[model samples]
Target: MSIALPQLKSIKIDKFILSLFSAIIIAFLFPTGAGMLHLKQVTEIGIGFIFFFYGLKLSFTEVAQGLKNYKLHVLIQLSTFVLFPLILLGLKSFLIGLIGETFWIGLFFLAALPSTVSSSVVMVSLAKGNVPSAIFNASISGLIGAFVTPLWIGIIVSQSGGMSLGDVFLKLIIQILLPLVIGLLLNKKLGHIAKKNSSKIALYDKTIIVLIVYASFCTSILAHMFDGISFLNFVFLFSAVFCLFWLVIGIIYFISLKLNLSLADRITATFCGTKKSLVHASAMVNIIFANNVSASLFLLPVMLYHITQIVILAIVANRIGKRTLNEAA
Candidate 1:
């Protein structure tokens, strides 16, 4: 099950990452255009469609099958939702002073996010891991996050005069939960279409994410929210993100080993547990912080962590795959 080293080396930077940054640059240059065009309303509609496609593509049978491995599921889910958030919360006192309150909140948001669906499964498969469990954990994590992320963020925002927890939940029901439920309800009929055109759907998802990113930055830039952030602050922010990735990876690996998981399950746990979804981040930020002009500021750590996870996990998965092949041979 070894992937070719050459193929691993060929793993280029994700184009979507480029698009994300480009959206930011474009937002900076033409900050007024998004507001002028009323892109906020457009992106909100796009967010609903994103979740609908998510529900459309999801197969309940596969999820049910994955439920048999309760221990594995529990570990991965806890790592994603509980362990990650707790760690950041524990470090909050130190991090806020070092990275600033806004950036720390961004990091907390990153920690609170769900495991990325596509990349988590892909990395597990790449490393010859328990792909089924990865798929299940990745999918379920998002559903869990839809509620949990709001609550987690609610704790912070509630104190700061942001949206009330009740309001956030209401918005989530309308924008995320309802659309997802509709997509699921129609899954029997339209699921094949979603599966058949997954690539197109993924493209659409990224397109919406780009639009959201652009619009968020446009709002922030117009308000000059980033003006106070110096270059040194960015250096500190990136360093914190890099360190945070490894710290979580190390803890997840240790916990997997302690759990005495099979190698395949360990790979699944490590990979899935460590992932954070930018797609969810984009959509949720819009919904959860709808009125916050500083919404884009919260996305900084998320974008940084997204890049960090992809590069680091690709290399880790490649090494593990190579080792597995060597041992088999």
Candidate 2:
């Protein structure tokens, strides 16, 4: 007898859902093996290379032109590096008693990360906005994140009694800065090569990101990150995060409309200004946590937030993109 299985019905899985699955499986199923410790070192080194490759792909020509659009660039960067962090900090007063220092700190870290590369660009492109601006802003955000995100984490965690300022700077420079600078200096040559092999390079880029996702979850599981986290507390934290992001997106949209920017510029403001990067989030975790429980569990909020943002933004982006395209036609 031949048996047939039902088709998986094109179930739309968001990036966050896939990432959350990876995080949970790593935390609960695998736990920590001897191999996991070694993987951490490999993960850090791999992340550096990831940024290096990022440098390789950047076109100086694009950056030169992107600089001319300084007003837009500054707006995106300020919204990402400044306005967003304040909101996360403001929540700390309310969140500390409710979710404890771990969740609060993790949320703060998520706020501090730069705007994302892939999703930000994709959303902007779909809405028929400034693709070149998205690319320029995302790349500049990553470079600054190599410093700002870690610096933000280091300062916050110190008051909470975890990592040191000097330690964080060292890791940021060596793990992130050095490679990125080398890649930048060599970009003119490397950029052409990268363009020629863009598809192959993306495969490598994805592999590195998957390794980071797996390692972070594995470490969290090994440390029993959920040990003291009650189900109710988790539920509350999730609700808070969902509300926080939607509010920010709405506020950005309203402000852009007030600014009277074109619909395309407004779309760029909403997408590039409101999102954070998973790649940078995972990398910054390496700089913050020194011990097991603190390091592993501290990563939870950002992990969860990544998924939440993706799922929500997917619906919003689709809706906005369609309307914008129809009007243009």
C-alpha lDDT of all candidate models, in order: 0.91, 0.75
**Consecutive 10-residue window with the lowest summed lDDT within model 1:** 2-11
Q: Pick the candidate with the highest lDDT.
A: 1
Encode model 2's per-residue lDDT on 190-271: one tens digit a residue.
Answer: 7898778877866666566666666666666566666767899888788877887887878787877887777777788888
- TM-scores, all candidates, are 0.96, 0.88
lDDT of 1 at 127: 98
Q: Estimate, for each residue in 92-117, the C-alpha lDDT of model 1 and write its tens digit.
A: 99999998998888888898999999
Please name the candidate that would achieve the greatest TM-score relative to the true structure. 1
* Candidate 1 wrong stretches, greater than 4 Å: 1-9
